[model samples]
Target chain A: MEFNLLAAFFATLTVATYFLTNIVYLRYRKTLLNPVLASTAILAIVLVMANVSYDTYMTGGSWVGTLLGPAVVALAIPLYKQRDLLFTNLIPVISGIVAGVTVGMASGVLFTQLFRFSEQLILTVLPKSLTTPVAMQVASNLGGIPSLAAVFVMVAGFTGYILGPSLLSWLHIDSAIGRGIGLGTSAHGMGTAKAFEYGQQEASMSSVAMTLSAVLGALLGPIAAWLLL
Target chain B: MKYIYTLLHILVIVGFYLMGEQLQDFFNIPLPGSIIGFLLLFTALMLKIYRLEWIESGAHFVLAFLPLYFIPATVGVIEYGKLFSGKGILLIPIVMASTFLAMASAGWVSQYAAKRKERSD
Candidate 1:
């Protein structure tokens, strides 16, 4: 009975907090205020202060996490919608994702090695640029902690969402496809959301790039793990 | 009635996910089942096996709450207190630099390709 009650309470808390932070994000339009980042921080702090264990919190939180698989499957809808544009720009789109995913994985391994992180930590960060669910899966397959992999994915997302625009502008990456692929490949879902601020084309391309990067990242993650670790 | 339709659509999407899982288990594939499900659904749509409207509303509903689904796992990071203390904080800069490099390289390559395509056209 207590488990059920706690489950309901934490589940409600998670949803309510997400909505509230989402409102704050919508109002401020700041990457730092991203709903995922804000809500994760809020919930983490609340749990820590209340002395709640991660296992206890997950009793309810897992219900929400279960939906992630379906949400990833749902990505097919947007990718389907953008099929025409994707094909028309196939050359740049494919090349950009290939380059970006390679560089994203390579750079992650390179930096983590330079910092002399543990092998497990290096594996965790290997799939950082992929979408959250895929990254977590890849991380686990590579013998890293899946939960920590999620955190690294978020860090990558936040980093790209915050710094991506200025970098794009400075680099004269003015084309919509270029901007979208750049952000999406580097940041995943958060980057796609940021890409929306540009225009429909950028948003569509970003979503496509985000999905494709997940596919490519999954295939490449193990290879990197083998080569680096 | 609308809610029923939405639920049914969601069921179909989830069904695809389960199918992907089964296939993965059977084949011992390296890819995640969710990704296999995504590809399966995308192919089904392309092949016109599933109409867009059938899954459109459900997909939208699910996608809207996508970020919410990630909270549980991300919050799990609190368990790794050691990773975030002291020198571990260096990860912030490391992540930032790599992300910048990725964005720059992708943008440059795609922009160059796009510009070249434009010139040829």
Candidate 2:
């Protein structure tokens, strides 16, 4: 098959699977089977079964990839919606995010060193806590492969979504604001999705934290890379 | 008229991005055009120059479709299949632990601060 045709086919197939997976997740609301994880897994399996190379998939995939920037800008809407809460908790929220992102970046570097991954991999792991679009840009700016950075972001999101509630409860940090910030700052979009289950306050705060973390992560990403690498 | 309003909102978003692109070039930094655009849009709303109602529909439209956009990039992870070998095997646990740490510390500090403020009040 021609490369363009294959790319188009896979792109359509991937989007369709994501739509279907989202329906299943909505019906089931299972954390283990979240749309992002489930859809990615199903598409990966399909590609492997079809013997399609990643390169071919990405050709048409890039069409979807191009929207990342605009979607990121759209995040400002939620941020704006929560403007009153932001103004009210301005100092504590900023401090919390500053602390969270700092710790998150530092620990990512610390783990990469402890694990003895390559220099290239170090850059990839540094911005793992941000949303995928912002994390990809941060990683690319810091000399990492953008796609690899997306994978790392997904890992962080998945772990946070799966374990966030348990971890929050174990720590006895019961504040809705804190729970939202914790999950959102650490896990990004997926974490915020889970936060919605907790309540409206948690969900909104998660959005706030997600936006703040993305901005702070972007600003701090280069500085962290320079200091660590 | 509503369609035109939405179109105008979309144009405003794209315009900010273009401005952000210029700022990115002028600053000679790694900050993304979209982020800078986000900042610009945020400032505008905060200043009351643009109302949320103007862009809410457009922004929500884009956001609702956000995950679909990431599908291609996630698929690209297959290219790094080699990372699963060697030290890469340890990545998942380490990443999970770090994510937990971030959540714990952030949650702890924020909760502490909020409690302190409440007590003072």
Candidate 3:
């Protein structure tokens, strides 16, 4: 009942559920029922029913979010190890990141406007397709709610995970690198997860794209907001 | 040998966070600590300030739970239910669908451009 205990409970619950769900995914190869998605849905449901606010949930959420720094920095080893591949494919990778991030941001703005959403909502929603912390900052700086940006990123990531592969198939693009970047550039981490399942090349490139897209999106999202919105 | 440097992960993360935060402020910007964190680690490895083991353990642990962080946000969407209350459930699907389409198109466009560049090379 106490807020501190309640927040702690949720935090523990978050970590526990995530670990368990991932284990389940490994055993069952996953489905529509990803642990992360399931856990998020579960917490959201509990918090609302209990009348706990976003601030309360964020007490725990922020802790997890803070760890993002270490995890992101860790990406360097994988990326650095892959430098030879990067060197060879540097042109394509850099080009893909630019085009992917630019188009993703532009279209997010364009589509939201088409829907008649206010310009503020447009800025908030435009950054949704990126990773959370970055998405939050992008939204915040552009005068959008960081909370809204967090929500959008989740929706976009899950949407990309659920539908990105099928969409790519529909487009008839088959290479692993293409598929990986396809998911990473458009969908962020969730998309990267799906890409990992595609194969070795898909996973590696997905990681590459995921990292590049996050950095590039962070850099570009605000600029796009200023110039376009 | 290369993997040995991977282990000092937490120190690497802390170092990056502090330095990255400063860099963002110095540049008069709002760089996400995570993005800068990665940049810091990447720079170190690229520059060989610390080897791979220098930060491997912390990095691995943090990445393992990366997906879970999004869970609360997705669930939080339920709060918006009343605001919708069938007023625009249809719009939800439309918005979601359009977002998906645009995201997919963006990815493909990037791929297309990348492939085109590859051919020219």
Candidate 4:
């Protein structure tokens, strides 16, 4: 009975919370204030006070996670529609992903190394640039705790969300392709969402960067682990 | 058209679920099945074997709700409420600080590379 009611509350809350966040974003000219992130902060406080287990949260949370399948499938149309543009500008995007993912990972590894962090912790950091679940999995396979990796994944997304545009502005990096691909590639889907705030091209490029970056991160994650270990 | 796209996605997921592990071992990469299959499908299309018609609709649906994936993530923030109030309060600055640092570093590198590419050309 308790579980059922929790699930019910989660279903209601996730949607309500999501809409609420979107409204907040609208009011702020969609500035760095990501409503979803903000609301999560609020909800985390509420849930902790309620003393709910994570498993209980997942009773409802998984619904959102399950949707990832269909969401990934949806990326196909934009890619197909933009097929010509893809091949035309393939070099820059690929170059961007390679450079972005490599630098991000290498820099992270270098930092952890400087601190003389444990191998497991360093491996966890490897997937910081990808999505949470995927990054978690990469960490596990390479002998790190998934939960620790989750830390960096969130950090990575927030990093991208907060600094992506500001850094772009600071560097005078104004090209749509460059901005979209770089953020998407480095930041994943959340970063892509930020890219969309800029324009459709940036959105699509961000998507492309996201997909390619996931693959590149997966491919490179273990290699980095082996060498670092 | 929409139905076909859904089917393509189903096929991609199933195909990967079955053989993705083997392929990952073969390539010596760390990618899981679903992701590897996604890459394979994209590669096939890029090679022009898998037609766009098969993937277009599903891709549209996926892209439409891409933002929703983060819907659950906000809940993640709530998970740390106790820590947030406790010593975990330290995490606020830690997370915020690192995030900004990581973003700046990534954005800067990308921008620098773009400029370098221009100058070299």
Candidate 5:
């Protein structure tokens, strides 16, 4: 059927584009050239050029999206693997993530309000610092558009990846844990990727921070919306 | 044989996700099912209810493609043309400034805590 063929084509296109972009990203190691960002931009342009509707593309794209749930559950593995470090640095880790989550949510709400964005936009921005899947979920839970939230999350990631290192050094935060927490809490996966450049300890710490922030961000998202918006 | 093993591992991970979804619907929990499954799996690992090896390869395989999973959602933004027009440009500065604030606060707090711990030790 035409439907099946179109679905298969779009799906293959998504995967192939991602595959190529990922290779480029790994080779060049530029934050701006992140595979997700590049592939999304590329695919968006291609779809528009082809005059393909979003729904039509999604018939295939949804197959890829379906894996996200299992991927999220798989997150527990890294969290568990890092359990020892997490416990050893429990106080600092917990305090850092809590502060980051609170500040991130509060600042987003404040700025959106200052700009006089709609309630929906405010909710979308509320979970901007969370990892993508979690942010999208939190956004929807707070009555925001999930896809819009995903865009906000990517913006947050890019912002943190670009500015985080300078901000950390300026603050004299030389500790691996500090750098890790800063990047991961503020940027999510992209931040964690940046943390890897710092060293093994920082990378692991960042991953833990990213995971914990996702959990904390989810719990706090609705509360922040209730209080601020 | 290896492929089968990987598929089986994926099935287990998916099973946990389904369980989480079921529990959420039954309890009317506000949390997303994936997160609930995340917590459940973490607890299971901590309690030794599931060995890491059983799920490690599958988890790695899935996580490796994690970024790929969200492309469709991001591409969905093409639908909302108004968001990126005019005043929407202002969102960049807002997001950047807020991200800096978050990075600064989290870094400062953790650095302070870590230094204090070092001194005490």
Candidate 6:
């Protein structure tokens, strides 16, 4: 009987928390605070207040997490829709993602050494530019912690999404595809979400960059570890 | 009828994912099953084996809720909360700076390349 009630609470809580986050975002549209950040904060606080264990929360949270695989597969639709534009700008798009991945990993090495961080921390930060799923996989492959990679990826994403526009304008990078690719390569899904706010073209380009960056990051992650570490 | 279509679409997607998993298990591919599934779907679309109408609704439905799927993992951060104290705090500045650099360089490179292409063309 107690288990059933907890199960019900867990099932309902994920949707409710997500809905509440959406409402907050809708009301505070000008703040540029994303639903993911807002909802995670609210949910974390709630769990702490209720004295719930992370394991208990995962019982329900994992259900929500299961959707990520399917959701990522669903991205094929947009990529299909934008196939023509993607082909037309293939060179720029590919190079941009390559540059981003290379620069992201290089900077990570530079900074980790500069700060004298542990090798484990360096491994975790190395894949921060990739999307969460790919980043996590790469981190694990490189002998780093997957969960820490997720946090690093999220931080990189939030930074890119929140500050990306200003940075783009300041750099005078005006091409929609360029801006979208940059944001997506750096921020992954969250950056793509922010790109959607700009226009359809930008959103599509961001998706392309996000997808390519994931593939490239995964392919190069181990190689980078071999070379750099 | 509409709901049936959506369900069928979802089944097709799941089928692709399973097929990709099978291939990966056999061939020892380095990439994930979902990515392989995504590529398979993209291929089918490109080859005209499946029309957009077949999966459009289901795909859009899943995409709409994509952000929610990430929350669980984000919450997983709590598991490692203790690890973030000493050396972890430095991650904030490092991640922020690298992200900025990645975005700026990517945008700059792509834009320059595009403009150069346009001028040459």
Which candidate tops DockQ? 1
- Give the distance in Å from residue B107's predicted Cα in candidate 1 to where it truly belongs: 1.1
Distance (Å) between predicted and true CA of B102, model 3? 5.2
The window of 10 residues in a row where model 3 chain A has the poorest summed lDDT is A63-72
Give the backbone clash total of model 5: 0
Each candidate's clash count: 0, 0, 13, 9, 0, 0
Residue range A1-229, candidate 3, lDDT tens digits: 5877867876787788778777877788765567866676667667778888877777776666566556666677778877776777776677776777777677777776776777777777777667776777777777876765676776677777887878888888677767877777767777878887888787777778777777888888778888886
Cα displacement (angstroms), candidate 3, residue A206, comes to 1.4
Residues A1-229, model 1: lDDT tens digits: 9989999898999999999999998899886788888999999899999999999999999888888888899999999999999999999999999999999889998999998998888888888889999999999888988999899889889877777888899888999999999999999998998899999999998999999999999899998788877
Pairs of residues clashing in candidate 5 = none
Can you list the residue pairs that collide in candidate 1?
A: none
Q: How far is B7's C-alpha from truth in model 2 (Å)?
A: 4.8
TM-score, candidate number 1: 0.97
Q: Could you give candidate 4's per-residue lDDT for residues A98-182 as a string of tens digits?
A: 7777777776776666656567666766778776656766887888766556656766776777777877787666888778876
> How is the predicted docking of candidate 4 categorized under the CAPRI scheme?
acceptable
lDDT (C-alpha, whole model) for all candidates: 0.90, 0.85, 0.71, 0.66, 0.90, 0.83
Which CAPRI category fits model 6?
A: medium
Give per-residue lDDT, candidate 3, residue A218: 84
Put down candidate 2 lDDT per residue, A1-229, tens digits, no spaces: 5977977876788778889998998899888777777888888888888888888788888877877887777788888888898888876677777888999999999999887888788888899999998899898888888988888889999888888999999999899879988988899998998899999988988889989999899999989988987
- TM-score of candidate 2 against the unseen true structure: 0.95
TM-score of each: 0.97, 0.95, 0.87, 0.76, 0.97, 0.93
Residue-by-residue lDDT tens digits, candidate 5, B37-71: 99999999999999998999999889988999989
Per-residue lDDT tens digits for candidate 1, residues B1-121, read 9888889999999999999889989999899999999999999999999899999988988898889999999999889888788777887788778888888888789889998999999
Give TM-scores of chain A for all candidates: 0.96, 0.96, 0.89, 0.83, 0.97, 0.90
The residue-level lDDT of candidate 6 at A185 comes to 89
Native contacts conserved, per model: 0.82, 0.66, 0.49, 0.27, 0.80, 0.73
What is the C-alpha lDDT profile of model 4 across B1-121, one tens digit per residue?
6676687765654454445556777886657654665656666777888777665655555555555565564465444445457644443344444444444454455556666767887
Stronger candidate by DockQ (2 vs 4): 2
Candidate 4, fnat value? 0.27
Q: Which one is best on TM-score? A: 5
